[model samples]
Target chain A: MRRALTLVVSGMVAALLGILALGGLSAAATATDKEAANEAKSVSEAAKRAGKKDPYAPVVYGDR
Target chain B: MVEQTTGVGAPPVRRVRDALPLYAVAAAVTVLVLAPLAAPGYALLYDMVFVPRQPLSWDLVAPAQTLPRAVPMDALMSLVTQLVPGWAVQRVALGGAVLLAAVGAGRLVPTERLAVRLLAAVAYAWTPYLAERLLIGQWGLLLAYAALPWLVRAALDLRAGRDGALARVVLAAAPAAITPTGGLIALGTVVLLVWDRTRLRRSALVVGGVALLNAPWVTAALVTGAGGSSDPAGVAAFAARSENWAGPLVALAGTGGVWSAQATPSSRAAPLVPLATLLLLILAGVGAGLLRRRLPPGTAVRLAVLAGIACLLAALGVLPGGAAALRWAVVHLPGAGLLRDGQKFLAPYALLLVVCAALGAERLVARIDREVAGVVLVGLLLLPVAVMPDLAFGGAGRLRPVSYPADWQVVAERVAGEPGEILALPLSAYQAYPWNPGRVVLDPLPRYLPGTVLTDDTLRVGDVAVAGENPRLREVRRVLAEGLPVSATGVRWVVVQHQLPSEVDPATLRDLEAVHEGPFLTLYRNPAVPPESNPPGLGAWAVVMALGAALLVVMAAAISALHRRPTAW
Candidate 1:
């Protein structure tokens, strides 16, 4: 009985973590998330504007 | 467990003397647990929590990069670091993990052995590293090291042929599989499992499953450029380029070797606070554990013997005159070579020393009359616990302000409110920096945990790896180093000092200014440097990989449980 319950819980935890990640990956950025996104984008843009460009130029490299 | 009869109808043995040690251990553990609550800021528990918690790293960088939650011996520190961060959450984590570990140990050993195990844990909990981690809030190291007793249980289970099907072993192996130096403990487990081939199939399943559980980290390392990357002899060459044979050794035991930020020399070892334990290790002749074994370790003594060998190999070097020891010491010991401080060993070695002391306590107790043994062992364990700060096992001190006050979120929000990229001076903050460097940067390619910079960029810890593969990014680093690309280029906010690079100096700071100062922190802002200055790739793939690995583990566990009637013993 205990073993069976543990199995159920393990599945539940994984599923929960998976769905959460998927939600994060797929969902449109929310107001807060977008603010965070903008913050990151600005940091990158500033790095470029400041001459500390994204040394890797990530968008073009291995974008496949 | 071994003493229990297998007959369907046989009544389980019930007796007092047989159970005395366990009860004594429980009573001792209770006292130790209560110590942290009463004392508030004991250093031993603080250090325990600090390393895994990555407290030092936080003191080094910006706030956005801090982890969502803390791990290990560092929980209380993480909480304290953040303004009495709610323990309801961390309490659940720490209590659950520790309880699960105790259950894991209970499955394999007699109550006496379990008590001995707990005794060892109490010793490590009280070590200087743990204390420092606790005070500073290094959750990762705390959880990882706190998981040591269970790893002992794991090793014993493997030896007993129970590794074949123990589900608890899978759960128990969780923290060790996840922490910074986890790979070492896992490697040690593999050695023990290999030593007992009778249960090869079972051992393989258990060990392999545990390793599989680490796939998220391993995959992160791989995708990030670790295992199959150009960094093999690559990055170490750079760290070692300046060092001669004598360098790592002197740095190993001495104060601040190559990585020292200070102008003067100082030994890196922390003053072990549970001083009685240190005296015990030397007088009891533990240096033997380091010298005795070379091949696959056979017994518990041998496993410990090898564990010490591994630490010494990292500490002294494994080769002749500490040569190989220095090499292995630097490369193999989970978080060694990369991070600046050599004192990382303080956590693991101190745990080992404490375990030995616990064993010593067990012996001391066993020798005396029954009534006296319980009293003496509890007294010894209680000494540290009783004085424990809020973070320690038996501490009575309230959580005091570490160099940084506990209001991390405030720091985070304040940094988020800043205009430019900031550098966390002491960059090894916590496990989060490894995952998210945008939150803090000592350098362009965040060193990630206790490893190196400019080296792998793979950012691998244990089996987990986060590949930072962008050849173009490398070229960018070279250019930026020559000089910040432009005013718009340099990092804007620096959480602390000393981590700033040559290029981003006077010219860089001409525009940047400190905007806010907390009780323990100074927030700087460069109105000219925008927040979007240097952005990293969205970790979409890494997230997929971590979730994927976690899924695989859950599946394998379910399938295995159904097929095999793993002896719960």
Candidate 2:
């Protein structure tokens, strides 16, 4: 009975951690994706504003 | 009282065998949190700026006009980057902060259980306080966060009259003393923990020594032309912010209420985060009793008082009537502006919380069956990481390093060829470069260039603009607002950065001659102004003397610590 109770509690804790980890990682990835999309959208908008004058290509500082 | 057997006289192999797991766990935590820093370039986030080789200019060592925010930190960075490249220095600093913080917390916990120690290590190192500070690029504060546990341990040892403990206290506080806020925190910790009427002389000596370490910034503040008062608007702008529906006070309770929304981890906004915080609080309460029983006589009460004061300070800006009081104090009281962003003061509370929670876990496991104890311990160990997993891989790649444009080096070379005061145009304090997408960084020109570079000091938080204290910059702004030409400002050179939303009026460049025009930065020379070298004055020398004295204390402490037999630290 004691061994069975231990296994049950351990399983519950493992499941909780797994759910929290998955949720956190998914949210983080979504935030990163959203940031990249916004960057691309801004670049496009800036190019449109510039028309044919230099195309307004900003220098790349670093990459992930 | 809690078996102070920190492997002092244990056999060498046995000590290493016992210590191996703690070190391994710390190493794992460091690697997990700072994985993105393995990349080559510098991570230029908000206030975190790194150049190839920072020049040891007088302005960096002792600010003549502005407040000494960076103070001795910039001076030390300039000195070190002269020998080691800035990239390596950045990596070592960030990595060492994470590793040392974990090890320090793990060692400081008054427990013999390796699992409990490991729990404290993971919890303390992976805290939201460290995460938010690291994300905001306040590496100096993170150094203090890392040094805190060691400082607390040494202070405790000093209270107990342990040999070599005073030296340990000095050595532990040296890294923390690099910045004004960190130095003040270290000083407060020593005074609170080491003060005893019976050992009044020793306590005074230790407190005075830490105060001397803080002297460099204090001396600089006195000599600066910019008066001590700060803008009252900053009190509202830098107040602890609410992360989610839990509000700001609860956020502070969890050690996560940094001012900037951009610096907070996304997982903190989860609805269930407050539940985790509540659980941790309950555990800490349960373990508080254990801590009181285990620590020597009055040590636990002193620690509790210290933690309470830290929490109160962190919540001060958001408390009832707190904002009004802080606003008045910042305007009327000197150096009270430091209390505006009170969330930074939460380091001691976070440390105490983690230690208590770890002890609480130990107490729970003590009553449970062995198998169930293992399961509970594992769960608690994973709790912090599970709740805030976004802190991994450099805050989910927010800390990715980027290389500066060749234009920076080109501009630096020209400025070095002919030393002169240069003005960074477009008049914005923070820049959101297309190159560093989705990140706002302070202008790197001040640190990257050789001579004094004038950048805007006004800080804009969302819609609120807090005024700066630089009289020269204020005058420059006034001239520009009046639509004057760059030549009329009397700055030797003007560098206009392109590709930002802020537009530079073509009329401002009327009387100036364009020097080197890069794709990113355009350098123009003002023929009306001539290059002049200003030698360091007496005020600068006073700051230098203070820095020298602080360095000597640390050196003396190091020699003493190394020579002592059976070191308590």
Candidate 3:
């Protein structure tokens, strides 16, 4: 009975680890994707502002 | 079969072999977390600015107009960068913080099981508190977080009257005392843990030693012309923020809620993350009994009290009637502004939680089958990393290194040749330069250049504008708002940073003589005010004396600790 219980517990923990691993990976990929999107936006903005004499001023400090 | 021992009289080879796993685990964690720092240049994130060589200027040592938030930290950096380059210093500081944090927590656990120790090591080092602080680039506070477990151990030893323990306490706390918030945490830890009615004299000495270590920042705060009071708006601006539906309180309970959303790990927003926090708390509760039984009488209770105070302070801004009370205190009480960003005080709570949870894991496995216990311990070890894997590879590449533009060096040289007060234009306290993409960093001009550089101090947290107490910055803001020329208000040099989102009106630079103009930064000298060199005053010297005294205490403790036959540490 004890051996069976140990096996059951081990299985539960293994399942938990798999779920957590997937969750963590998805979150990390989301952050990377966000960064890439921001970079693309910056590039487009720079192209639009090209040849302009006056500097473009955004918000001094970013949102929290 | 062979037997091993780690007692005082154990063989040196055996001890090293026994400790090999802990060291390996710690190294693995450090390498995994800081893999991005292996790149060539400096990582200049917000408040984490490192220059090639920070000139030893009086303003860096002691501030005359502003609050001494970075008091001895900047001064120490300036002194160290004189010999060692800034890039090396940055690597050492970050690497040492992560590695020492893991080892310290692993060593602090009372369990005999190696798996339990490793659990504590990984759990403590990979905490959300450490992650948020590191992502926000508050490396000084991270040093405090890293030093805490070691400090607690030394304090416990001092309470037990162990030889050289007092010196060990001072040595452990020295790194934490680099910043004011860290200093207070160290002082609070020593007082709570080491205070004893039986050994009153020794307790007083230990507490006094840690107090003196905090003297540099305290002395600077006393002498600063910015005065002690801060804007009450900051109480709301810097409060602990809720990452998910768990709310701010649950976030604090899990040791995850920092003020800035940008600083928090994205995984924290997962709805299930709160469930993990609940599990950890339940485990901590299960292990509380073990902790009380294992520790010396009253010691566990004292640690609990310290942890309680930390949690209370961290949640004060979000609590009922707590924000109002904190607001009133910050406005009326001197040095109370330090309490505004109370999440930084969570270091002690994070340490205590990890230690207790590790013990809880031990208790859980004690009654199980041996093979099952091994599997469970392995699962526990992987839990922290599993929950927040993005902490690996430098917070998912948020901490990538970038080289400073050549314009910075040219501006520094010009300012060094003729030193005077510099007004940084486009008038922003923090900047998002084109060179350092996707990172909002504090204007590096103040530390990179020689003389006193005045940048805007107002902090914009979302849409809420938190006011700063620098009188000079306020005057400069007024001058600029009225559309006055840069030369009219500035004492000497004016730097106009280009390619930033903020624009500097061409009319503002009409009267100033352009000294050096580059693609990134433009240096303009105000011909109206002649260049003048200002020497350090008596207040600055007093701060220096306090730093020197703190150094002497550490040195004396070091000598005393080394002289002892068997080191208690």
Alpha-carbon runs more than 4 Å astray in model 3: A15-19, A22-64, B1-5, B565-569
Ranking by TM-score: 3, 2, 1
lDDT of 2 by residue, B276-314 (tens): 999999999999999998899888999889889998888
Better of 1 and 2 by TM-score: 2
Model 1 chain B: weakest 10-residue lDDT segment is B259-268
Give the winner by lDDT: 1 or 3. 3
The C-alpha lDDT values of all candidates are 0.39, 0.86, 0.86
Two-way lDDT contest, 1 vs 2, winner: 2
Candidate 3 residue lDDT tens string, B16-94:
8777898899998898788878988998777789999999999999998999999799999999999999999999999
DockQ of 2: 0.18
Worst 10 residues of 2 chain B by lDDT: B1-10
What's the true lDDT of residue B94 in model 2? 89
The TM-score of candidate 3 is 0.94
Ranking by DockQ: 3, 2, 1
Quality class of the docking in candidate 1, CAPRI style: incorrect
Which clashing pairs does model 2 show? none
